[model samples]
Target: MDTDYDVVVAGAGPVGLTLACELRLGGVSVLVVERLAEVDTTIKAGAINTPSAEAFYRRGLLPALAAVQEENLERISGFMAQRQGGRGGPVTMPPRFAGHFAGIPLKGRLLDASDPDFTGAGPAGDIGFIPQEPLERLLGGRAAELGAEVRRGVELTGFEADDEGVTVHAGGSAIRAGWLVGCDGGRSTVRKLGGFAFPGTDPSITGHQAMVEMEGAEALGKGWNRTPTGTYAHGPFPGRILTVEFDGPPADRDAPVTAGELQASLRHVSGTDVTVTAVHTATRFTDNARQAADYRSGRVLLAGDAAHVHSPFGGQGLNLGIGDAMNLGWKLAATVRGWAPEGLLDTYTAERHPIGAWVLEWTRAQVALMRPESHAQALREVVAEFSDTVAGTTFFAKKISGVWQRYDAMAAPGDHPLVGGSAPDLELADGSRLADHLHDGRALLLDLADAPAIRAAAEGYGDRVSVVTAAAPGRPELAGLLVRPDGFTAWAADTPAPTATDALGGALARWFGTRTALPTGPRAA
Candidate 1:
């Protein structure tokens, strides 16, 4: 069957755009259709966690992220000054600002960076403050640069998928594609049309987040505050307010948020008559957590919010979606490019479903702690105390930072500690890092101790894998490593060449398929 593109991606949000870029990098054609003519400027996620940052870093996008972070830090500094009544001069983010759990601050100073999850994580291991709007724009541009076609104002109204290819109806035109992916967000049209079963807990809270001009705002306390009725936070930035009430989900979630409605919510949660005067932007949210029963069905697939969703309490939504894209992109491309092993594409759901489930439960836990009941308040106090200790702070930091995220299925039984985890940015003898070699999106086999057997194992994969011989002086125990396109360590060898060859060969075959007759052209250090 003739297809317009190898993959047709619905929605040009960060997830879709990032996937488009990845598919393009993997040498597959991708078409990204966004319903909106322009990027949405709504206030969404304020930061990207460690794993998300590291993903960007591996793709050599860290310089762009750093630029965005600098701008955000300046804006944050100004907001801090305004919060302090303009007395402080250029207030910077507190050194202890790791992140929060149930609105409880986790101090960075108390966190042990030497923990196994964190050691050798490199510079992108920290949380990066780049809001959703800019992030989408960045990824959108990157997708285009990588040769993915992005069409705006193209709504995916329907699609028909069979054993061969998918015919997608968008913007009153039917386009054919080898595969279709839904990144269209919570109310995903692709997911609905594809008959994907979504199930999860119902919401018990109605939350309001907005930026507006208001009167009597001084009556509300600054930062996160839990009252007898609910929880409210005021002013990290002037006119920025958020309130959560356990009064059931909004009657009309799609209804426009008016200043009067926000005022009432603020009054209810803050127990003060803070009058909202002029509303600039506002939205309603809920703890409506849900996950698709499966991420794929035949040629139709789902990623980002189309696959899972939960409360935005811990700022995990965008990061989680980015992860879905990173995990799905190369695998889908491999399948499209015809080198994927049997059931390689099926591993997407197997590897990512568990992570999505964990995020849902993590958000639900925060919701439980925020409940207006007296018991919840007591539980919050206990959790708060736990967060204050060194171990507790490190634990929460690992979770919030995304350092704790590892794919158990990606590892062999009794694998090295680095297996299933992001490859440490090992600096080679030539002063280059592992990430420096991954910009082209090929799998990498790093030989630290000049192992001919390990190098021979990576041969015949052609350009699918790049073998680099370099000594990583920092990690003397690591003799060799197989790093996947997404920067996960597929295989690690601390033993000698003979002992590691068979395992290396198995990993190469498992991920890159059967070895070909292509010449072994190992790149020099």
Candidate 2:
């Protein structure tokens, strides 16, 4: 074992790299391990959500991802077919959900940013899907730039934790760290070695993925337009209709996927696959699974796929991982820097665990409807209707596009009028934008309403807080909302309230310290 680094993260996927970068920014000496000799180049996750985009944007890596693939998918819900006991049935789409069914959103998000509550504006906060490998390369470089020690061909064999920290085994040697995070995928050795229990339901069906250059399949529609046996997946990716088919049974991720097996399934699902000019790769996987019982054990933590596994039905697995890293990053950094409370570490599990379950709940319902059928007719009808519901459409759009992530579950206090809401681009007193002011990657309080309460709170704290006052209502969209650094609501107040100063001050003290928890301080001019 070697001397202790501040942190050690296993599995250098995008999530892992992001976590390491966040820790490095907090002055943590980090070591990142990956079993693969090189980064993966597959375009696995084709979509990026807003939270991930925002996180990457903060780190200046979104442009790299956007440069690689800039196809923008706006709406959400789509159809995925599954096979049941070798019985081929009708293609049934998950119900259209009429307008905006909350139930469907609980499934997979449809691809649209049509929600009224959603403000899709503010300096390009949108989701984009790119292949995972290249995405990691870009992020890994950024992580290394932030001082993370990235090591390829190294693997985390195991780890031992005590009251102080953890000693990680990787690269044929032992490495000590103040903390460890497992960002490895579903078949996580870190999860296994830590004796953590994965408590969630199993996937209903397995999926066979093939990056085949099929002859005549054209991605003609917005969603997965099917032809009996195959699905035409036209995404942000150029010149490729991601063609997929459901075959006999779901195989383990550890199991090998073959072009031959996928070719046969294409014939079964599409009814006439004809021939594959080139099978880039065929892989079998399932849509089932959820989170670990705990995200932290002693000094060891888990993020990304390591903490949760799910049917990629809504393209959520990667997004989920990204979200996990984001959720843990700031809190870990805050704790490391002494700004956060002792219980902040526990919030990672409490906050993110529910989100993991939420992903599973969304995917499980969506996967169930994607069952294999003799014909594609039934599936078409389902997509058509799902294309109509608020819940379903919002879910799909939010899931695939990454907007459905409402930060209500974030542990920051929510009683404030605008605490758990999204902050829009507002004009500051100097006419600069509120978002531009947040370039520091920290929590921001914009006194757009010019509420006396907020003015006084800032004065009371002095250098402890950086408060920006907007001259007038900035976007009209976020007129009364108090946004957080994570682009979520912290506490909101009526700007023109007579007792607004006292009310707002009390609200602020609740989350940021004594100031936000108790607002009895005198109002500043």
After aligning candidate 1 to the native by TM-score, how far in Å is the CA of 272 from where it should be? 2.5
Error of 1 at 432 (Å): 1.2
In model 1, state the lDDT of residue 14.
91
Residue-by-residue lDDT tens digits, candidate 1, 254-371: 9999999999999988989889989988889999999999999999999999999899988899999999998899999999989999998999999899999999999999999988
lDDT of each: 0.88, 0.61
Which digits, one per residue and each the tens of the lDDT, describe model 2 over residues 325-394?
8778767776655556457678778767877888878776655445446433466457657666655556
Structural similarity to truth (TM-score) of each candidate:
0.97, 0.78
Top candidate, metric lDDT: 1
Total backbone collisions for each predicted model:
0, 66
TM-score of 2: 0.78
lDDT of 1 at 97: 30
